[model samples]
Target: MMDKMILKRLMNDHKNIAILLDVLAKKNHKLSEGEAVNFALIRDVVEYMQVYAEHSHHPLEDITYDYFVKKFSSPCNQQLHEEHSSLAESSGALMYSLNLILSDVVISREKLISDLKAYVEMQKAHMQYEESELFPLFAKQLETDDWDKIKLQCEQRLVDDPLFSDTGDNIFEDLKEHIEAG
Candidate 1:
């Protein structure tokens, strides 16, 4: 079984990502309505998705997936594994497209918004699959020793997440304010 602390941390990451997606969706709606969007806030939100969600969160899940696959020999989780890889690329592309738009370059706003929605949907689906399918599988199959090893591996793979970290980089201030206000 996955350790309680590890499971809680991963679940919290999913929650945080969900909050950011809602923030991004709200920004997209404002843009669609021809209202002024806070580009800086959008940028910060994208950066968090790229840095913390894609970079840190996905890889940790990948570790869990890897361990699960090693022990269980089930192919059912393959799609979720593939989604993890694709999400990183999708998030990177979204960030790049957002940067171009912010630089006064004319990219199709519709396409960018479409991509953002797609990414958010895919991420949410991925998390749901993990919570429903993968986590339960891990809990049933993995033993205490297995979790100990996975925990050590996850700790070694951990990155200091700026959005969740104590260091107050003010870029996330707007995003935090938006989350609280909503």
Candidate 2:
């Protein structure tokens, strides 16, 4: 299953996003309990989603999804693509709220937590849909040539994950420690 590696990488990316979502949820919990929420950390998480995940992960999947739709006439592509598009808008809202908090504005904690929860849940559900439905369908439908095209597209657009890269900044180090300590 040569195409499986690509799917696996996508799955790992999903897992990584889940890691960030977990931290976000925890922060929300802390906020609910009257503890200070780290708006900077929340901003970083949203930034990672915007910069790395959106730039690299979604484009790769869009290429693959487009291929699948064209080659196999699947109807699943549109919903997944729409979800991908909505991610940016939803994340932007989350970032907007976080920015308000960061700037010492008096945004409601309830609204911030609500937005974070909604964003995290939406991301998790989208990843699960791809993993459960789309990946298997692709494995059944795609040929070597199709996968080759995908590989080439991925190579052409490389976006290194700043938090997970060897050359990554230590900005996420505290987040990583929190993840490990949990």
Candidate 3:
């Protein structure tokens, strides 16, 4: 079975991503008003989503889903895999738009907001699906060996030098603290 601790940690990470999504939404709103885009902040959010959310979260699910496909070969695993594929594509598109925004390419503010909103919506829905369906299946049906493989893959995929660290010394901490204190 998947480790309960790992699962919980993953959920916490998802929560953090949700929080970041809210912040990004606000930032997108400001940008649409022709306010400063805050490229550094945007970069941080993009890096976090790409590294922790996509790189870590998706690989873990991929491993878990692979095991499920091997054992079940049913519609459940197939459906989840299809959703993952769609999520991955959306994420890639979001990243591409973010890059353009950062580079000061003349992207329409409306289009940027729309794309960003789409990414956030898709991710939130994807998480809900996993928590409600895939996670329970994993808790009930996954073997210890299956979990071990997941852990190994997750460890291997972890970025040793993340583009932006969450160290207390960073500006992100200050931003988060300011948001919390308000």
Candidate 4:
């Protein structure tokens, strides 16, 4: 039951995160076209990803993937682990870039747009790889004991989704409103 819940939550997070990525893509498009883009929305999306996706979602996946590695001994597990850490690093760097731009530091617009596009593509690819390849393996092979251990570890450090959660201190109010308006 807990395993199903965890998997379901991860999948749901992918869906929500995907929407934000699309927003990023759109903003990148606007910038590439020399049009005004909402940097705040980009920052909000990146911040949410840093907090929820990096600190929360990726760690939960690490827990699951760690257990999976122990059980299955697959060759691709190392790559999976690295991808999580790499993405977290990317989010941090992106957040720093956003902050600099927000503070009126002269960041190159083309560089920022390139970074956003690359980050979005990496995220989409990672999620797709997990959903298509790893998730099915997890669904079929992860036993009750594995699930129990993963659940316990996950429960120790769960972070709530700020934008989508009813109980979170929603700091990204404008981003949320924009999402809702569409």
Candidate 5:
């Protein structure tokens, strides 16, 4: 039983990630003239996806999925788990390709774009699945104690990467400011 607060926080983080994905997708499509597909910004996006998004966020979902699987023998848990695996695999492959391109190896920009597109699409679909199917189920099923446990696990497992340490601070501050302004 995941905490409602934890689920809410996870959903908020997912929204932030979706925004970043949109920004990356737009920026990627508008690659500067003569700029490699694996530009610095592209690397940053891939790093965030690999470290912050996949590494941190997915583990929480994995725990939630585990609980659901144990609680219900329905097909939903199995399908969601499969979707999670697919998203992780696709995102990891895309990150690897981006790293290769960043390693000074000449690669086709088209291929990089293709991989990125696929990754983004997969992520978008996965997010929708979580929001539409998984989140509501969690909210209904998880007790406060379950949520507290999940929160503790999330905090303990949090990765302290440069992206999270540096960029996250400013981004979240800005978000706070924006919310306050409104």
Candidate 6:
């Protein structure tokens, strides 16, 4: 039951992430076209993603992947775990770049646009890997007890996806409204 619930949330979270990615891609295009884009909004997206990924999504995945590896006597993909930290760093750098511009620091629009494109692509590819590889592996190999264990482990570290939750972190209210309004 918990496994299924976590799986459902993970899939839904990916969809939400995709929407943010599209927003970034579109904003990047606008920036490239010499249009003024909202730097704070871009920063909001990155900040919220880092918060959710670090606090909720990645930990849930770690529990699930840990159980899978334990049961099957096979190693989880190194990238699956390493990508969390790597993406965090990447998102942090992107936010830093946005912060610099927001502070009136001169930055190259083309460089920022390129970074945004790369960031969005990286996120999409990461989601695709989990959906295509790890998810199916769990469905096929993990036992009922494994699911229950993974579920219990998840409960121990549960954190709501702030952007989607009614009682989410207060900092994300504006970003939530923007996503809902979009």
lDDT of each: 0.78, 0.81, 0.68, 0.86, 0.68, 0.83
lDDT for 72 in candidate 2 is 74
Candidate 1 global Cα RMSD: 2.3
Give lDDT: candidate 2, residue 179: 63
Root-mean-square deviation of every model: 2.3, 2.1, 3.7, 1.5, 4.9, 1.7
Ten residues in a row with the worst lDDT in model 3? 159-168
What would the per-residue lDDT of candidate 2 be over residues 1-182, giving only the tens digit for each residue?
35555666777788888888888888888987889777887888898899888888888888888877877776654787899899989998988888887888888888887888889889989988988888888788787777877777677656666777667678678766666777
Cα RMSD for candidate 3?
A: 3.7
Please give the TM-score that candidate 4 achieves against the real structure: 0.93
Clashing pairs in 1: 1-142
Candidate with the larger TM-score of 2 and 3: 2
Question: Candidates ranked by TM-score, best first?
Answer: 4, 6, 2, 1, 5, 3
After superposition, candidate 1 runs with Cα above 4 Å error: 165-171
The better-scoring model by lDDT among 1 and 6 is: 6
Put down candidate 5 lDDT per residue, 1-182, tens digits, no spaces. 54476676678778777766775677567653445342655666666676676677787787776766666664554666687678778777776776776787877777777777777788888899889988888888878877777677677655544333444555344433433454
Angstrom error at residue 119, model 5 = 0.8
lDDT (C-alpha) at residue 109 in model 5: 72
Off by over 4 Å in 5: 1-3, 32-38, 72-76, 152-155, 159-182
Cα lDDT for residue 93, model 6? 89
Give me the displacement of residue 57 in model 1, in angstroms.
1.1
Per-residue lDDT of candidate 4, residues 1-182 (tens digit)? 56567787888899999999999998899999999877878999999998788878888888888878877787554777888888888888899999998898989888898898889999999999999988888888987777877888899657678888877576988999999998
Question: Candidate 6: what lDDT?
Answer: 0.83
lDDT of 6 by residue, 5-122 (tens): 7777888888888888888888899998999888898998999888887678888988889878877788556888888877888898899999999999998887898888888888
Best by TM-score: 4
Candidate 5 local Cα displacement, residue 118, angstroms: 0.9
Candidate 1, residues 122-176, lDDT tens digits: the string is 8888888989987877777777888878888888667766676667666577677
Model 1 has an lDDT value of 0.78
> After superposition, which runs of candidate 2 have C-alpha atoms over 4 Å from their true positions?
1-3
The runs of at least 3 residues in candidate 3 whose Cα sits more than 4 Å from the true structure, single-residue gaps closed, are 32-36, 143-146, 158-182
